[model samples]
Target: METSSVLIINLLVWFLLLANVLSFSTFEKLVLPPSVTGPESASFDRGGEGPYVTVADGRILKWKGPSVGFVDFAYTSPNRTKIACDGTNDLKFGPICGRPLALSFNYKTSDLYITDAFFGLLVVGFNGGLATQLSGGYKYLSGIDVESYTGNVYMTDASLTSDSTGRLLKYDPRTQRVTVLLSGLSGGGGPAVSSSRNYVLVPDYINKKIQRYWLQGPKKETTEVFLTDCGSPKTIKRAVNDGEFWVAVEKQVQQQPVLTEPQGLRVNGSAVVLQTVPLTQFSDMTLAVVQESNDALYVGSSYTDFVGVYKN
Candidate 1:
């Protein structure tokens, strides 16, 4: 949690996550615009029309199409300046420029929620521009997801305490209150809810597993390890086609953490590896999230200036 400044740029280098892609194929690079970099996480609208990404320059850009390319959708910092912050990877400008990490959309409300490293939770209307902060004072905010049914937002953070533990927290939009759902998390991306809403999976990146927190059941409020040896999952997202999850993972060598080849692992609730998509084709880029929209996979990275999409 103390690694506040170091965390902004070295997220993938420290802990990682990703979605799903197919096997035996290469990712088509969606090279980012000038000066912008590290499309760390990707999200699509309810209408299935995008892969709007949060970039290093502290702005979220929407991909309109190949012709229109990426246009500024929303920004986190009210003090953000195009001249000073645009397209730069420097962490010193985070507080002034607002370093955003993960984003999700409320399908019903059509409001986009974001987790900014410096600004905490922020939201913008469907119209997208400068975002309004909902909450702040969180340290090392990473992943975020919204439950469409309740409109409640759940997220993970490396807490500010010296305990060196991560936490899974929930925000109720109705009450505008934040509560700690679970603590002692190894901490990765946002908690992923089951389709049934019975439980949510929070990735423990350092431990290379996912901790499942029960939301509804006899086991409600209990915590358990759902998946082990999950290859340092970067991001855990619900799959587009199946009732499963696509996790971006990095294979660990000899139990010591090393950033080696990153891959896409699709798995079911029973902890079965359904499919593995080799992502070594991207070469040196440390791929973070491989989110799927419509039918194609959109891959984002913390070390590159592009979001690689897999095309047939």
Candidate 2:
């Protein structure tokens, strides 16, 4: 009887191992959709700079996705070709681009400011960029913005489940100081600095509203609903010249696309409708133009895993 029991246990172990092998093999075969249609959120109304919105399959990160932080896009100057996404690798300082996060460029300083989900606010140069560690000991530093004039850096600490708390912070590059700007966001994600350089545009995840706040005191500011019922508004950016902006929304909760959030939407032509478009599969954040220009619109997504070139 003891021998019989032992034999049964051995068989069970073998069966379980077999099942796991089969499951892993099946998972490997699962492929994502190649292309997507128009926005599912609203009617087709359009939109940016150098790169025309052409679906480039090259942007997909085969190994990264929902687990990542902000997926931002940046184009090199002059011709504005060759886009860059953050946190796609592992490096000590300037190597912040490969880690699954967001990035913005300070064209004045020739520096790239990055929001690292794991590392906090950082700055690096292009290709051989100089990386600076701006913050540490925060739950998650998800979004980043820079003052084009003063080079003051503002970032979001999206620490939804932490005791220290989530807050928007200001960092002075000249003095190397960091200060908390605001706290009590449900989950702070995307942040766009107004072209006038006085206020900021943010998607308050918990509140489910797009908010505009003053750079100082914020008490004299007005908060209006730019768009309602957006899934988890991830990143926000206002055009440098045109007063237009973009937002990336996310809905899924599973094997998640790289963008996991949504692609993005375009705002233009003096419409109060504030129409929002969905970039299917592309999730997380859409770090867009510092200022709108004659160049084509360039957007990067984690789901689609490629930078989209849209002609304005």
Q: Identify the candidate with maximal TM-score.
A: 1
TM-score of 1: 0.88
RMSD values for the candidates in order, in angstroms, are 11.5, 18.8
Shift in Å, residue 47, candidate 1: 1.1
Please count the clashing residue pairs in each candidate, in the order shown: 9, 43
Candidate 1 segments whose C-alpha is farther than 4 A from its true place: 1-26, 159-163, 253-259, 282-285
Kindly list the per-residue Cα lDDT of model 2 for residues 1-312, writing each as its tens digit: 999999999999898666533321211111222342111111001221122211122111121233542222332111112234222222232222223255555657656676654446666554422345666667667677677788988777876553435576788988988987667666757577766676776767656556666765554454444565655566676653456676655644556343344534545323232444443324344332222233433344433333443432
TM-score of each: 0.88, 0.56
Clash count, candidate 1 = 9
RMSD of candidate 1 to the true fold?
A: 11.5
Query: Worst ten-residue run, lDDT, model 2?
Result: 36-45
Q: Report lDDT (CA) for all predictions.
A: 0.82, 0.48
lDDT for predicted candidate 1 compared with the true structure: 0.82
Q: Candidate 2 versus the native: TM-score? A: 0.56
The residue pairs found clashing in candidate 1 are 16-234, 17-234, 17-235, 18-235, 18-248, 19-290, 35-87, 36-87, 143-190
Error of 2 at 264 (Å): 2.8
Error of 2 at 240 (Å): 5.1
